[model samples]
Target: MTVNSVLVLGGGFTGLTSAIALALRGVENVTLVERAPAWARVGHGITVQGNALKVFQDIGVVDEILRRGFGADGVTLFHADGSVMMRLQTPKTGGEDLPATLGALRADVHEILVERALELGVKFRLGTQVVSFENHGDSVSVLLSDGTTEFWDLMIAADGIKSSTRPKLGITAERASSGLGIWRGVTNRLPEMTGGIAYPAPGDEGAYKVGYTAISATQCYVFVLCEPQRTPNDLPDWQEMKRLMEPFHGEFDWLRESLNESTYLNFQEIEWIFVEEPWHRGRVIALGEAVHAVPPLIAQGAAQCVEDALLIADYVTREGDLEAHLTEFQERRIPRIKGVVDASLQLAYWECHPGSPDAQPGRVMAQALAELVAAP
Candidate 1:
């Protein structure tokens, strides 16, 4: 079992972090292949939870991320009418070892990871796609879209929700409807909003809800979730977005004006999935959205992926048997990841279908759990 080189597919947060972790461990022959022409992430903003921040610190990129990202105190939830329902504050645990939670553009985090990986001598192949692979007992031969083949001791598939490498590994996934569609955007003018507040709208009048968090004194990240609807493919029209937001306009004084003033409105169809038996044949492993994609309700998508990177790296470094390592990694991760997926789906259902008796109880339980976890 030669454990000299590793090939990481999909250079997103998970892939990049995995490569960096291996590189930091003196694994020189680490290669990251991304389908995009350059290093960039296609999302508005992401919240870095406490657990993930600790992982970043371990990997030596916490400072870089914090320097370039926004530090968020906590999250707040509200009714569509702007009445505060719940608030989760970042409790100060009496320890200097605790890492700060951050909310920043996904691109910033990706850039920081890519730069660190490159500095650590990790090879990055942007615009390159992994077409297929053949696992020959000791090594896996990966074929790229550009007619090139390479062999590596291990392969990490970090491709997103619709991962292409998953099928090749014989892992099947089941999609769970989130019951809501989301529109995310950023506005230059700061709205009278604070972090961690989730606004749930009144009865199914389009089932609209809006949330705003101050990324900076001058800028805010805003999002609106409603019953799913068809959105034009073109860059989301701000006017159309405003119109969609019309139903809830004036419902919440802060959110109503913010929606009208926001310049960027990007619509997304939210869906959840749980891959049955996350690990595949010995050499190949899937992480991040590829293995268990959850709705953004919990905001732990990236955090969970970061955890996966660390756990996989730790397992591989400690365990000699490749099959055993993969199995152990899945065993430790599947339960937690599935818990998050279920929790997120339940939250999405609560937000989308508020009136259903089944959803209400789950919503209350989920809220209580969230409060408990967020408690300082």
Candidate 2:
């Protein structure tokens, strides 16, 4: 591609990572835009697996993340009454020295990536969006919301699952829902809580699951998954959340007591989108959620997106035609992405159809992690 200048769209985890990565690669004149007016920290937590941590380390941000985040060796499965059934040791794929997993407040990660990207000399354009773009085969001309048009040798569409850039490319992808919804909140961390617990929930015809993990020394992220009649904004109140917690005991006791009106909640549908092969057309290419968005069942969404950034950056930095560069990038990514997206969907299915005798969510998780840790 013989890239010089580059334009990165969106400023989420993947977008920011891409921009920072490009800058770290010494790509001068890199510009990143976000539709949002400003960068704000989001509340909630994100579980970053070892693979993503490797990417962070490569980008020079893992130290800050580890300082502010909680590290865990593995997670344990339990009954509602807190009887531990099994402990799954997360693979330290990044390296034996790094923790198998880390849980950080989503906002904290956002801020960390943004700060690092900015410091690396990546110019961020907040409150700006791509109104349109033209792929000249050699370069891409982008029309911005602020009323300016610019061209670059390589254009990365790290926008997101609902990427405006994808539709602009006339690539329509399908997203599947697991018929599951999740309600999440952040609360004070519990004493001696190192990892997390996932308990099989009762009362629903399908098996529902509830889990919580420490995000920091003082806080943790709590989540509930189940088949809901309809999507409602957050739990009605703390009372409702507490009722859901009734089936949980032991480690969940602190969470139940910590539940109060002041607690913030977020509710969302569990969905996955599969963007087809050939993730790029000419100079415009898409990655991350823009191409493959899987359920959080396996917590690989960000990890996979990180892989996209790392791989795309690796290939794009080389000298070649944009077409060849993108093709080679997809060739290396498709197999790995397929394993992650499929395994995530499988685990989601198990959560939704708890009685399915064929379900093997643990096995799926183990296999996927093994593949992720093996190599890029």
Candidate of highest TM-score: 2
Best candidate according to lDDT: 2
lDDT of 1: 0.70
lDDT, candidate 2, residue 200? Answer: 56
Q: Which TM-score value belongs to model 2?
A: 0.95
Task: Please count the clashing residue pairs in each candidate, in the order shown.
Answer: 7, 1
Lowest lDDT sum, 10 consecutive residues, model 2, at 198-207
TM-score of each: 0.87, 0.95
lDDT of 2 by residue, 1-376 (tens): 3787889998888888988888877788789988889887666888899889999999999999999999998988877777787889988878887888999999998899989987999998989988888888678898999999998887888888778778777787766676777778888865677656656555533227778888988888988776644334465666666766777777777687888988987767777788765678778888899989888877889998987898777788887666787788888888888888888878887777667889877888998898888878
Clashing pairs in 2: 1-320
